[model samples]
Target chain A: MPTAQGGTLYRGREGMWSWVAHRVTGFAIFFFLLVHVTDTALVRVSPEAYNAVIGTYQTPLMGLGEAGLVAAIVFHAFNGIRIILVDFLAKGPRYQRVMLWIVLGLFVVTMAGFLPRHLMNVFGGQ
Target chain B: MTNATHGTPAVAERVGTLDAPRSPYVRKKTTRGNYELYSWVFMRASGVVLVVLVFGHLFVNLMVGDGVEAIDFAFVGGKWTNPFWQVWDLLMLWLAMIHGTNGLRTIINDYAERDVTRGVLKGLLYLAFTIVVVLGTLVIFTFEPCPAGADPELLASFCTA
Candidate 1:
């Protein structure tokens, strides 16, 4: 039997870590979505107000923050798909570890494609 | 598997059987058939779609053309004018709200100790979720980036033209 201590500390297999990561990432995205919706809703108030709010996001600090958000989103999305397969497919739980590696591989590749472009847009000269 | 009496200790001594066994802990079984199963399935399906919708939104708003600087009222107005973007934004709004709300519902169920507390918290959560989603959907569909009656100075420059 698994001990509560081990489970709490995430001292289990890849599946456990994935579950924890999913929860963490889910919370992060949830909070961000709250703020994002409020800010986007500013558009309905006035053009100036909306632009001013979004303009704050153009700074170097926010650019870095955006990168972190993107990373959270990518990991959560990839892991979520893995979870779906495991829950739905007959052979999925048996090969979950293999699927995890595939998810990680996809995450890295997608991030590689996204990061350079995002960084260029943020840091590169006009 | 036998229908043992409530006061009988024999039920406790019995091993696993084909019949459903009682547990010390109270199990919150679902009354609705396959609802939870479908809900789990929906999370995955919506999540996959959200990945695409959200990434596309970020890519366009923060990376395309002049990038983040180009995003403003007029820019949004231009995009919303296109049926494609309108639908995209609509899907993103609905999917993300429902997905996030359901995830939080799960969290609340897991963590909340008291039934009343859990119900109250979930009630509030659902209320907030409904308000935001409904308002957002309305705004997306009814948005006029440049209202004719609005103050011209406050309106986007595109509106003045």
Candidate 2:
């Protein structure tokens, strides 16, 4: 018997999350890249001006902003890799889920390694 | 020729109840080669690696060296001057763009109803990928730490006048 909506619970094409994640990450990376380009472009203006631009980034707010940038790039790259695999290789649906979890686990691990170094530089004054 | 199937011999299988089980709504076909299995492995593997590579890139660029304050002409110039950072940035760029494009390709195939639409969308996607990846790679490799005959103060703090 069908559900209230009269459709099977999870009957549809393959790799739903992979598609969604790719789009979400793509937009996110685009936004981050725009900001990055604009900021980097400041260096071309003048030395002191570039210095001034860079100086503003030292604030805690900027650090937090960067934290987000890191996350966005990571998700986009990893999920994008997943989509690439699906399109070119034709992997299994069950295996895709397994790999996604692996990506998540690695994300956490890498963040653990990097965040400390960043926080040390930021808050600890290292 | 016969009325239907014209000279085609219709040989009914001798075995009874021999068909493989399948879901009612699901299409049944013999599974393809192990290539798909490998693709599954690549996604997870690349995904795991990307998380590290991409995040490391962001942290270094945006957060390191006096946080964002240290970032400037000198900042990027200094970073890219080192082959190590250059490689890092390059990896991040290549990986993310390819990944994103592949993801979008899947979406196009799943959503687009007509073959023509799918082909057009994929063509556009590939074009965009080419432009971004090429531009980004060039910037990373060819960037000059200092432009000739440029104002010093306007340049990065580290650049010699």
Candidate 3:
């Protein structure tokens, strides 16, 4: 009775929403992964090309980009972990809110810890 | 069969189906749930973030300066030698892994009907996730672009004497 529409979960309004996200992120990650693997293959492709690619990313803007990437990964990873737990291990609906909050908390904690270091290196002394 | 005038209400009726709920197969019926809503929000949020992350990566690596040709062990080695690249790489690794895994989780849930089957597949997913995340995080935080001693050919120029 605690859920959106009483205690029954499947009947709730959010099932489709979750389904959509899973699909979108799934493909998004796949595309990125495919490109990533190919690009990293540059290490084997030719050292010159690899070096070139590396040099470009050394920019401060790119550093900001990477920070966003870290945030994405954290959200996806932690949420995925939550889904897995819900589907298999816990199988308890009562704990979902708690899990969500925990995921959010961890994400904040990680960013707080990493961002300062990143900024310091980017803007601080040589 | 459930008749409007007679005996038992159909299974459909119980779950609010237009027809009477008759299926003995119907287990517990839930009137509603919120899990799906969160997922919807997550997709949009992740999508926006992914757009930035993915494009940022592409722009920097493919569009900037000397571009694709400049990437190499020494180039990469030099970059990773810096703390910034290490963090950048770390973020990319973590995001892709998590996003992909979550996406797959949805696929599994939607397709798998049997609880036991779902459990097994999800178990495999979790196992793989753990291995990848652990190995990846370790590699990023502890990456040694240039080791202490290695063949001159294999080592970056900076690594060699």
Candidate 4:
């Protein structure tokens, strides 16, 4: 029987949470890629078919979904770099908690820059 | 064998030593040599490149002048018509698919305990990967910016020129 208890160093903390987020986001992004490729392939069918499919992506609902997707990508990208550092740098494990904070900071900043422009484009009317 | 008449109870002949089992000892090497090691390295390497490729893609497509609203057949045709954008998208498609496929493979292995279950999930995953990669590559290579029968309104402006 596994208990909720975690040892002093790794579990029940930033390290575990980051890993969990990484997996969840990666799972979502993978499925999205499959669907995206399929949709894009509609171009080969005909211009009308392609436009009909892509038109849905411009809707407000899908725009919000895109924002969420971008958020996931940004976090995953920053955290991925952190993971590389952890793998290659000698001092990586020691400063992993700090690096996670840095990753989060970058996520916030990137999304801040992205969300407003995307939302305006989606809702601002052509 | 001791005789009962000698005051020692008869004992059946021992088939094997108590310390060792009857089955032959075969070492269980759980991993195929270096396959998983290479996968781990590939994930990291591809991840770095994907960060660059994917970020640039999003910035150009989503954060540029009109964002998602500007996307349509014309937008796509215009971009794919250029050799630079063609190569960029091709690389993005291949690298992203491979990276995502490998990530899903790791997830499937971690969660799916049964051999049959793991095999089935991975089979589907790889199948999807193959179809998407081949389709995307062909689309990039075969796309026509202007089809004679296509509605001019739907085609890129440059197509008419």
lDDT of 3 by residue, B1-161 (tens): 64756865676566785445574565566677777778666655665565566556645653454443345576566777788777776776766666666767877887788999999988987776776667656655554566554335644677775
In terms of TM-score, which candidate is stronger, 3 or 4?
4
The residue-by-residue lDDT of candidate 4 on B1-161, one tens digit each, is 44666865545334343347577776777766988899899899999999989999999999998998889999998898789999989988998998899999988887788999999999999999999999999999998878889999999999888
lDDT of 3 by residue, A13-105 (tens): 334454345456455555556455455545544555555566555567866765665566556656666666666565545666577778779
Interface RMSD measured for model 4: 2.0
* Predicted complex 3: DockQ: 0.11
Model 3: residue B22 alpha-carbon error in angstroms: 26
For model 1, residues B1-161, the per-residue Cα lDDT tens digits are 35465555575656544346564665667688897888888898899899889889978886688677577778878888779998999899889999999999898887787999999999998988987888788778888878767667655566778
Tens-digit per-residue lDDT, A17-60, candidate 1? 88878988998898788788878888788777888898888777
RMSD of 3: 12.7
Report lDDT (Cα) of residue B47, candidate 2. Answer: 64
Which prediction has more favorable DockQ, 2 or 3? 2
Tell me the lDDT of candidate 1: 0.83
Fraction of real interface contacts that model 2 preserves: 0.31
Weakest 10 consecutive residues, lDDT, candidate 1 chain B?
B14-23
The candidates' interface RMSDs, in order, read: 3.1, 5.9, 10.2, 2.0
